[model samples]
Target chain A: DQQVKQNSPSLSVQEGRISILNCDYTNSMFDYFLWYKKYPAEGPTFLISISSIKDKNEDGRFTVFLNKSAKHLSLHIVPSQPGDSAVYFCAAGKGGSNYKLTFGKGTLLTVNP
Target chain B: GAGVSQSPSNKVTEKGKDVELRCDPISGHTALYWYRQSLGQGLEFLIYFQGNSAPDKSGLPSDRFSAERTGGSVSTLTIQRTQQEDSAVYLCASSSRAGLNTEAFFGQGTRLTVV
Candidate 1:
């Protein structure tokens, strides 16, 4: 069973617009959620994260909103730029345990000019 | 000073043969983890090593797989009698410590092809 799932295989957005990516999970144990951006042949880079205690976390143009009751989360990038295009993976951890992360299949976001 | 590094970026071996993949975590990072990525199973945790704590091997798939970390700096993942199903990109990551919410830095990863 896939504990985490990213239903959208890919997404396209216009530059300077807001790009939103969605993810869902079946595991309720997960408390800390994070977003990682990856390029071809490169490992995923940590972008932003949100603790279960808070509904939202923002850094620069990236913001992550989490809805625990819905077991869903979304990543928003305002004024998206071409450089923001990459495969985004949503990962979650239970923390306090082993800090092991479970990642989604990833959504490839393309920002067009 | 440098980020995590993995050797033999790409390895192709015949079935029934054994292959070894190595990883060097960042200097002073007390936590290391190994994972496998495949189409069948998005990404699965293989193992983890944290300062003297008994390594977590629960994620290991079978007895044919094993891994070890030496001097708390380098780690090697060995596959005995490889099978076609074992073909996938193996990733290694490390963090300052296995703290509650510290992020991990990953290596480029070693792509293993079992032919």
Candidate 2:
């Protein structure tokens, strides 16, 4: 079963606009969430993360909002640039255990210049 | 000084053959993990290793797949009797500690193709 799910397979956004990607998880044990951006032939790079303790975490142009009750999370990039175009993966893990991350199918975000 | 490094960026092997993939974690990092992404699939957790602790092998698909971390610095993932279904991009990652809410650095990944 897919514990984590990214319902959207792909997303397209215009430059300078805001891009939002959403993810959902079925495992209630997951308390930590992370977002990674990946390019072709490259590994996923860590972008932002949010602990269950907080509802939101922001870094520079990227922000992640988590809703534990809903078991959902979203990543928002303001003033999206072409460089931000890549596959975005949402991963989650349960704390204090082995905490091996469970990943979603990933969303391909394309930004138009 | 460097990030996680995985060797043999790409490998092609025939069915029924055995393949060994290697990973070199960042110096002093105590946590390492292995994951694989198959075609049109999400990243699948394979195994995990922490400093001196019993490795987590629950994610391993079968007995054909096994991994060992030696000296707590390097890891090798061996796939015995490879099958076409085993084809995927295998990724390795490392973190400073285990079971913490910290991000793990990833390697470029090793693409394995079984024909």
Candidate 3:
């Protein structure tokens, strides 16, 4: 069973435009959500994350929005750049910080310069 | 290095052969986890170790897969009589602690190819 799902396999956007990636989860017990970005031949790196209590969290150009009632979340990269192209995975965990995370299949984002 | 380290970045082994993958987590992190990403698939949890507590082996795909952390630092994941389906990029991660506020750091991953 895929508790976390990123339905889109890939997305393409123009540089300096807004890029949004969506994710949905079936497990409501998951209270913490995270986004990770991976480049070819490299391990995934943490991006932005949001806690259940909050609806949005922003760091520089990346922002994450969580809707508990919808069991969904999205990562928005404003003014997307070519370097932002990569595979983005959505992960969720229960019991807060020290929990095992369930990951989505990932969505590959390509930004054209 | 400040980041998690994984050895044998690439390994090609014949089917039925056993393989051992190693991981060295950040120096002070106490929570270690193992995950694997198959081709066109998401990261699948494998196992987890936290301090002296019993490791969580629930995510292991089969009896042929096993991992152990020695001295609470370096970890080794061993696959016995591996199958082609076992080929994937095995990743290791570590966190200062497992809980609400900590984030895990991952290694580059060991890519295993079973031919």
Over 4 Å off, model 3: B99-103
Question: Candidate 2's error at B17, in angstroms?
Answer: 0.7
For candidate 3, the C-alpha RMSD (Å) to the true structure equals 1.8
Top candidate (TM-score): 1
Instruction: For candidate 1, give the lDDT.
Output: 0.87
Weakest lDDT window of 10 consecutive positions for candidate 3 chain B: B97-106
Model 2 chain B: ten consecutive residues of lowest lDDT? B97-106
lDDT for each residue of candidate 1 in B13-113, tens digit (9 for 90 to 100): 99999999999999999999998887544567889899888999988899999999999889999999999999998989888967323468888899999
What's the CA error at residue A89 for candidate 3, in Å?
0.4
Ranking by TM-score: 1, 2, 3
Steric clash count of candidate 2: 0
- Predicted structure 1: clash tally: 0
**Per-residue lDDT of candidate 3, residues A19-112 (tens digit):** 9999999998999999999999888888988989999999999999999999999999998999999999999988774457788999999999
Residue pairs in collision within model 2: none
Model 2 lDDT per residue over A1-113, tens place: 99999999999999999999999999999988988899998888888888898999999999999999999999999989999999999989886353578889999999999
RMSD to the true structure for each prediction, in A, is: 1.6, 1.7, 1.8
